[model samples]
Target: MQNMSLRLRGLWADRSGLAAVEFAMIFPIMVAMYFGVVEYSSAISVDRKATQVARTLADLTSQSQTIADADLMSFGQAAKAIMTPYPGQPLVSYVTQVYIDSSTGAARVQWSKELVIDGAGNVTISGTAPHTQGTTVTLPSTLSVAKGTFVVWSEISYKYTPAVGYLVSKTGMTFRDVAYTRPRLVLCVTYPTAGFSNCATPL
Candidate 1:
């Protein structure tokens, strides 16, 4: 019994391999943190790319006086290019030309188009009637989209799945961004394919 106690005391006093034991215990946590940092960085990069995608679409579309089906396809390609490095992550976007009515002093959706691209490289375009047409969704008062003028509204949404990050709330974290800009080269832009939308009869 006395030798057993002595052995126990010797074991307690021996500090050999202490650092290795502690490192072994904490190794998993350190790995987790490292992977979390990588995932977090990836998320931030994707979010920023999504934002740039929205802005790029809006900017490119707004520059055009009139947009045809082929032009819109080009814009879609541009958006897809912005997300090139991260393959398989799709980009869903909407481009709406909103009109500020002089008669009603309200902003309404003149024409809207939506596009969805999935991980498998499937592109879905909305063909149904644009519902937001004439919907009274007001714009920010601070900005001035004058009466009889048109502004391009772009919205982008991306679903990011973190590989290993504790900061993520769910498996699919959706990041959304919206931007609006008046036409740079034209008073109004129109989708020529949808209901034959034009500068005068944008529907």
Candidate 2:
């Protein structure tokens, strides 16, 4: 028993393999932490880029006084440009002009254009508003338009896929953002060819 005790004491005093053992225990945790940081940072970048995408689309549309099918197509193309370094196909976006009726103080969609991108970032556009056009829909008081006033609302959605996808709870996360602004260049933007009209209709 004394010999066993001496051997244990010698082993306890030996530090030759301490660092290797410590590193063996710590290596996996360090690796996980490193990967976690990289994935989280990448996700944040995509989310913020998504917000900018919505804002840029809205800003571009608001600057235009009129939009046609071709114009809508151009707007969709612009959305892909806004995505920049990010792949655009995973993005879905749309632009709508919300008009407020002076007589009844009701807001409705006047014209809307939506865009879907392909794997190569080319956009396919649909001129229909996702929500009903020329029909009353709820609007935030802040977005409330004055008599005959119009606001352009832009909506965007992005699917973020991580390089190490398993780091997140799901394989990916969906990020969405919406932005609204009054028309910058014209009282009411017109989409005469969008299959819907009556620019000044009140609610």
Candidate 1's C-alpha runs over 4 A off are 1-10, 122-124, 129-131, 165-170, 200-203
lDDT per residue for candidate 1 within 108-195, as digits (tens), equals 7887888777667655676753446667676777876667778898888888877654667657588899889888987788675764
For each candidate in turn, the TM-score is 0.85, 0.89
In model 2, where do residues sit more than 4 Å from their true spots?
A: 142-144, 196-203
- Tens-digit lDDT track of model 2 for 103-188: 77777777777788878777787545676777776777775467767788889988887777657756689999999888787676
> Best candidate per TM-score, number?
2
Q: At residue 50, what lDDT does model 1 achieve? A: 90
Each candidate's number of clashing pairs is 0, 0
Q: Rate the local accuracy (lDDT) of all candidates.
A: 0.79, 0.79
Query: RMSD in Å for candidate 1, one decimal?
Result: 2.7
Clashing pairs in 1: none
